[model samples]
Structure formats: C-alpha cells, structure tokens
Target: MIHKILNNKCPHCDKGHIYREKNIYFNFRKPKMNKSCSHCGYAFEKEPGFFFGAMYVSYALGIAEAVAVFIIGTFFFENTFDLRILPWIAITILLLSSFNMRMARIIWIYLLKGV
Candidate 1:
C-alpha cells in the first residue's frame, strides 16, 4: 500500500506503469497516462467522474503534509506562533502540488479499481 501510494503504481501489481511518462516531475505539463496497465492491463480510468475522488485524496494529502510541517517546525524551531511558518507551508504546498495531484489520482484509482 505504501509503495503504491508513494510510487504511484498499480496497487495489485507494482510492475505496471500508472503513467506513461518517465517521471512525474517533468511530466506535469503533460501527464501521459496509459489507458491500461502495462503489466496487468488494468484500466486506469474506468469512467467519467472516476477521478473526482482524487480531490478528497489530494485534500487529505495536503492536510497531512501541512500538519507534518507544522509539527516538525514547532519541534525544531521552538517557535510557538511564527507567521513565517505560514509562508513556508504555502511555498511547500505550491512546490509539491503537482506531485500531490498525481498521487491523489493514483491512490483513488487504486482504491476503486475493482469497483
């Protein structure tokens, strides 16, 4: 599960490529997703609105990331209430938004693949 979520591969089989591009970083402008899995041939997108669930996944990931940053910053910086933390979090989210979007969709596909 962790591997599937983090690497964005088919949950049942890791050999398949969830996406067609070499990597997600440079492929943001054009996400070339395979219509079906290369290994298992599992359909990546079943129907319209299938990926809507990815929104929830994205929100969950964003919240988790924000909370993690808040906790780590509070622990190491020892700053109870620092306004800079807000900017830092915002920047982090902005930079990671692409990856978050892809991961969210991948997770959603994995969860609802059988359905």
Candidate 2:
C-alpha cells in the first residue's frame, strides 16, 4: 500500500506513471498529465472533473497532518500551549503541501480503482 502511494504508479498495472512528469516539484505550473498509462494503456481521466473528489481527500490529509503535528508537539515538545509550535506546524505543512497533494491524488485513485 505504502509502496503504491509512494511510487504513484497506475493502479491498474502498477507500472505506468500517472503524472506526465516523474518529478512532483515541477508540476505546480503546468499540472501536466498523460492521456493514458504508458504500460497498460489505462485511462487516467475517468470523467470530467474526476479529480474533484481528490480535493476532499487532500483536505482530509491536511487535517490529519495538522492533528498529527499537534499530537507530536504536545507529546515530544511537551508543550500544548507553546507559541513556537504554531509557526513550526505551519512551516511543516507548507513544505509538505506538494507531497501531500501528490499522495492524496494517488490515494484517491487507489480508492476509486478498488471500487
């Protein structure tokens, strides 16, 4: 499960790339996508606005990440009321935004594929 999410492979074949580019860092501007899987020829676009559902998944992921940060800060930093953790958490989420978006789409595809 983790391997599939980490690699962002096509759920059908588990081989082809989903995004047009392998590097996630570069896609913010173009949001490039392949028409179909290179390996199995699976269509990435299920329907128009199919990825709209991915937004909700991404939102859930962001919330989960924030909650995790809060828990870890409370336990490890030993300070729930510490003001320093706010910016730290924000920075962490900022840095992880791209990775989280990528993973959220991957997870969303997996969820739809299983159904």
Candidate 3:
C-alpha cells in the first residue's frame, strides 16, 4: 500500500496509475488524477465530496513538514527560537504543496479502503 501510494498506483489494483503524471514535482501545474482505475475500474472518489477529507490529511502533512523543517533549521543554526527559519519553513511548504496534495489523496484512499 505504501508502495502504491508513493507510485500513485491505484490501491485496488496496483497495476493502474491513480495520477496522470508519474512525477508531479516542479511541474508548476495541478496534478491530474484518474477518475477510476484503468485496470480494476475502481473509483478514486467514492462519492461527492469524498476528497474533502483529504484536505485534513494535507493540512496535517503540511504541519508535520513545517515542524520538521523548523527542527532541522534550529539544529543547523544552533538556535531554538530564531525567527530566521520561518521563511525557510514557508518555502519548504510551498514547494511541497503539490506533493502533499497528491500524497494526502493517496493516503486518504488507502486509509478508508478497510472501512
């Protein structure tokens, strides 16, 4: 499942891709997702607004990434409370926004697969 998520493969039938592009980073364009699995015909969005939950996941991922950046920056600079890392954190988040969105959606899909 983790492999599938990372590769953007359909959870239902790992053969089919969930996203149109194999790599989404540095493209400066929104990632395009397939409506259903090409191999298994499984729907990506189970219902209307199903992906809304992915927003929460994305937010959590952003927070985690930001915290990690802050911790790493502090350790590198030997300053625990320096505000200089704020811009770096923001930049990291901005750069990873697209990745977080795709990851969040993939994670959300696998998370609810059991239910």
User: Could you give the C-alpha RMSD of every candidate to the true structure, in order shown?
Assistant: 1.9, 2.2, 1.2
In TM-score terms, which candidate is top? Answer: 3
Summarize candidate 3's per-residue lDDT along 19-110 as a digit string, tens digits: 89868555558888899999999898889999999999999999999999988897778668898999999999999998899899999999
Q: Rank the candidates by TM-score, best first.
A: 3, 1, 2
Superposed by TM-score, candidate 2 places the C-alpha of residue 97 at a distance from the truth, in angstroms, of: 1.2
| lDDT by residue for model 1 (1-115), tens | 8766667677658888787766774344756778888898888888878888899998998998888888777866756877768877887788778888888888888778678
Best by lDDT: 3
Q: How far is candidate 1 from the true structure (C-alpha RMSD, Å)?
A: 1.9
Quote the lDDT for 33 in model 1: 78
Please list the residue runs of candidate 2 whose C-alpha ends up more than 4 Å from where it truly belongs after superposition: 25-29, 75-78
Candidate 2, residue 49: lDDT: 88
Clash numbers, per candidate: 0, 0, 0
**Whole-model lDDT, candidate 3?**
0.87
Model 2 TM-score (2 dp): 0.83
- Clash pairs, model 3 backbone: none
lDDT of each: 0.79, 0.78, 0.87
Q: How close is candidate 1 to the true structure, as a TM-score?
A: 0.86
How close to the true structure is residue 73 of candidate 3, measured as C-alpha lDDT?
91
